[model samples]
Target: MTRKLNLLLATGLTSLMLLSPAFAENMLRVSYPEDPKSADAQMTTDFYTLPLNIFDRLVESETTGPGQSALVPGLAERWDVSDDGLTYTFHLRKDVKFHNGAVLTADDVVYTFDRMLNPATKALNTDILTFIAGAEERLDGKADSVSGLKALDDQTVQITLTKPYAAFLALLAAPGASIYNRAFTEAAGDQFGLTPETTNGTGPFILRDYTLNDSEMLEANDDYWRGRPKLDRLLIRVVSDPDTLRMLFESDEIDVFDMDFAPTQTPYFYGADQWKDHIVSGPRVGIYYYNINQLKKPFDDPRVRKAFQMSIDRQTILDKNFYGKGKLEDGVMPRGLRCYAPAEPIAYDPVKAKELLTEAGYPDGVEINLQQVSSWSSRWSDMNQIIQAQVAEAGFKAKIITTDEAAYLAARKAGDSDAYTQVWSADFNDPDNFFYTFFSETGSKTRGYNNNDPEVFAAIEKARGMTDPAERCKLYQDLTARIVDTDAAWVPLFSLDHSFVVQPRVKHFIVPWNGWSDMSYYNVEVE
Candidate 1:
């Protein structure tokens, strides 16, 4: 039978399982607090891929470290880099085809890169591809084509770069680089992500059905480039409320739970003998913090920024809000990475904060508006409120504003907000990946705070140019201390620890450094 027909049968079986509890046991029911804004393969964040199994990338990393080893062979069977480190040649695997039964070709790879580099597409991750020769020119509409990309043959692809980027291979492993069937995407039109049952990619699974506010269903692609997935069906349920998710997991209605409950409440659940076997904890890949618009008044001065940072009690907030479930961050880089520098965390001193505010020309008090998303994890909201109260005591009146998720993200992206809460996850297991995106001048200065300082920009360029890992590490270490100690672009908060629970019967399940697990290898069997 064709893969399409098999997917239909699996959908039918899943619907039946929803009515009967027996077959439901075979389905891997997972729940997340926030749903993907889009699943059009090319237009969504990485969170969308957690449920939809219809996409794969060039290579994958081992959980060991920044080093990457090959996993499921997608379009490329094997690849080699030129000795000068300017060219990469990939040998396409034979007999691989898209879900629509179209044979894979180098033309598709070229087309994919072209679409991604096009400014009209407005892909969020265009920066990752900027290293390609002429990519920046193409993106700026100055070049007719990307000079670095070429199709040597129907089964061969070649890419040329202006300089060597050590993390280039890892960048290809991201979802932004996932290959798509051009014809399928074009035919689906604007309703592609909104459509439920769509087949367009060459991954291990196909999207069988999807509901915006309800659930998404996937079935193993028997004709997958590597091989069929072990699981027959996958169900991703969207539950926005954390309390409801907790109840669902406690009742065994869902096999996977993404966020851990508040630490103060953990004892009530796991303390019970019945729940002891269901708990698991792991390190989170993101840092939770607040960003002050460095371009705006009051915060524009480094002394004001340092004063603000000293006013908040990070440890107290972590203790009360997170129940000491996370670590206080003195530097921007998370402690797990080698480039992290151990600096003394600014102590809470209301007097020192008042004196700095006075020096910044705010003698009486400075009033600031703080905005946050209401639907974010409860710990975040609580932490914001704590800071608001604490900062007021230090001669700054902070007013808290909360909005729905959609409005919050829209305002943040538009760079119209004064102060807001945000998180940064490592894109490629590099400190540059974290700091460059937020602190650097060329990075996303969503708050209109561009680090136009010549010296700082020079340091960033130096770090980017160095290909040696050890030399790069030193450059980043110095850059981190300078940015945190001098510029005060953002106030470091805490490195969160995301916790989850999995069924013991599931196998080959590893939590990636970025908090995403590739579920293609996961299997469920009777113990």
Candidate 2:
């Protein structure tokens, strides 16, 4: 290590120790820009990286194979799907232990899913499990327990889905599908998982301390099912400013950080010769686009919505906000996924936008409010400014409104915004997350502007159940056209390429495309 880095690490950690006395020399320090929305694990919208460390999913993902992730044994030692594809029986691993020293059982897994699917819990991501039979009924209060979810024994669990879904296992890999200790959670009641005290899981790390929005600490689990984690503890410090991330990295205070590069700092990261080996970047299978409220007047007309789409030059916005670091697309799905195919890019024509507005009975053009989450770290606000200017040339009065994340989300959910900037991160890397999440009945209704077209919803559902790769890809391609061209549910924009920094001492740290993983940090060690 450089003499500079050594001295900085020693000094920074010395001060950290004063605050968190449990932090040992083997601890790994890092920074995040947001806080976990809920400790309940069910209600959180923000990905603060605590739940993935605190909870263990049924099937884990290892990035050893193709696509975003390949499923591997996690809490479940082995699992089987029925010949007809409706039933899934999992054999739990014996000797697995939760953080609180209780042995994990099938009942705990059953309890966790029941709690998540219950409408009373109001978990934000329960759509991941709506495929399980009786899920909707359970969520709708028609059933006390998911009829499809039954614990056959202490070490065996069976799940029956309403239909075949190829992505079901992949969905299980997300943190929302985690297995928890039943005894601990039930005793905690509605307060379960709201604090460090009420949470217990079968993960490699145990929650040691959390200071709300400021900082959180996780100590290594000695009895972790896979094995003991390498580091003694891991610290997640919330530093919202991208500039502060670089400052801390330069001072050697934080060993690792990801995707915190600001537009101005893009040069230092891509141009710097000294830190060449320290940087890692990849094209993520994700999409960022505009969510237009079709229920609104101007947007209610498909022509006006199409005009809004063509007015702003996506290429220019990519250049200005992200420095040409992202790939442009006309279709809603991104490029890197196995099933992706390119579509004709929407022409950047202000003249056509004006013509469309006139044809739609708005010769004087239309006025609409655009919404974006207020965050200096977000490029949406920056892009909205350019959009407002570009749309003005097309005879539209674009009023820009900025709000905190919560209010923005409420507006979107209430279908109150004419248009709002939205981003989609591939939870398990598939076109299903693209088409089904935003365009289908479940996905669309959740948004402020929803598409209730029965044909489109049925197509997405059918494609998800198809097993043949060729057939599935064809269905997805057709669905993509329905979304971007026919339905115009979302205005296609650019897919991001992200940058992650790992100091020379950090080992086995791989940044997944979606930016979060269950075992990635568990394997990381400070050399």
Top-TM-score candidate index: 2
Candidate 1, 1-527: lDDT as tens digits? 23543555555554444424564545567765556656654575566453236766556544543212233345687899887777889888877877779887888888778778877777677877889999999999998789999999988989999997766776776667777666776677666556544547777767667666777776667798667777766777777776787777767677766544324445555566765566655566567777887656778788888889888888887777665767888777875543666655767788899899999899998988787777786656777788888998778888888888788667656655667776676666667677667766656365445555677777776676566778888788777677778887768888766555666655545455563433343333322
lDDT of 2 by residue, 419-439 (tens): 877677677766787787778
TM-score of 2: 0.84
Weakest 10 consecutive residues, lDDT, candidate 2?
A: 1-10
Q: Which ten residues in a row have the lowest lDDT in candidate 1?
A: 518-527
**Which candidate should be chosen as best, given lDDT against the real structure?**
2
RMSD per prediction, one decimal? 4.3, 5.0
Q: In candidate 2, which residue pairs clash?
A: 39-193, 415-448
TM-score of each: 0.82, 0.84
Per-model CA lDDT versus the true structure: 0.69, 0.77
Instruction: Work out how many backbone clashes candidate 1 has.
Output: 0
The clash tally of candidate 2 reads: 2
